[model samples]
Target: MQSNPGSPHSDLTLAARPGAARQARRHVARVLPGWGMAGLADTAELLASELVTNAVRATAALVAAAPGEDRPPVVPPDRLGTIRLRLSRPGGRLRIEVWDADGRPPVPRAADADAEGGRGLLLVAALSAGWGWHPARDGGKVVWCEPAGP
Candidate 1:
C-alpha cells in the first residue's frame, strides 16, 4: 500500500475503467491491515468495490457525453477520467472516499429483483453507516461513506 506523502491518508488513483473497482478492492485489502483494522477489511473492501464501480461508470458516461472542453483526459483519445480512492480515519471511523470527474451524484435506483445491475448504492446504504456526495471545488464530485461499526 502506498501512502500519500505529507498526508495522513493513503490513496490509489485508478483509470476510470471496469478494472479499477478490483484494483481499489485490492488496495483496501493491502492498506487496512496496517491501520490495525483488519477485522473490518472485508466490509470495507466490499463497500469500496461498490463505490469504485459506480464512480467508473459515472466517469465513463461523463466522458462520453462531453468529448471535449476542460475535462482533462487521463489518456490520449479515450477521454477517460481518473478515479481516486482515499482511505482516512476520522473520529475513529474509516472513511471511504471515491473521487471522480463527474458532477452528478449517485442516485439509488429501484431495480427489479431479476435485474442484473443497479444495486450498488443499495448495498452501500445497507452496509454503510452514512453515505453522501458533494461537488469538488475543481469540478466533479466525491462520493463518500463510512461503515456502521468497528
Candidate 2:
C-alpha cells in the first residue's frame, strides 16, 4: 500500500477476509482527510466499504467452490486470495476501486426494505457521482465509484 498521504493515489492489498471491509473503510477515512478531502470522507468510506465487501465475498466464494473445501466459517490467510483497494483524486473527484479475482460484473438487485444485505451496488449508484466496473488487464474485474463531491 502507498504510504504517502500527500500523493493523489493510494493503494492497499488485503486478504479476502470478513474484516477487509472495515480496513477499506478506515483507509478511506484516513486518506480522504489527509488529502484535504474530509468532505468526501463519509460518503467515500461507505462506498469503499461496500466495494471491498463485495470483492472479498466474490473472492472467498470462488475459493470455497474449488475442490477439497468443507466450507470453513472463515478462510485462513493461507487459503485466501487478496483483494485490492485503490483510491485516487483526479480532477478533484475522489475515486474508489476494489479489485478481486472474480470477473463477474456487479449485479444490483431490488432488495426488500428489511433486507440486511444486497443493496451495495444500489447505494453506490445512488450516492456516487458515477460508478462502473471493467475487466482488469490480467484477470478479474475492478469495480469503482466516485462519490458526489463538492
Clashing pairs in 2: none
lDDT of each: 0.83, 0.85
CA RMSD, predictions in order = 3.8, 4.4
Question: Alpha-carbon error at 28 in model 2, in Å?
Answer: 0.9
Worst lDDT run of 10 residues, candidate 1, spans: 71-80
What is the per-residue lDDT of model 2 for residues 1-150, given as tens digits with 9 covering 90 to 100?
884767889999998899999999888887887788898888888999999999998886877675675442333455359998999988978899898877777788899999999999999999999999998876778999999867
**Model 2: how large is the Cα RMSD against the reference?**
4.4
Off by over 4 Å in 1: 4-7, 66-80
Q: Would you estimate the TM-scores of all the predictions?
A: 0.86, 0.88
lDDT by residue (1-150, candidate 1, tens digit) is 456333467889898889998999898888877777788889999999999999999887776765565554333343346888999988768899998887776899999999998999999999999999998776678899998777
User: Candidate 1 versus the native: TM-score?
Assistant: 0.86
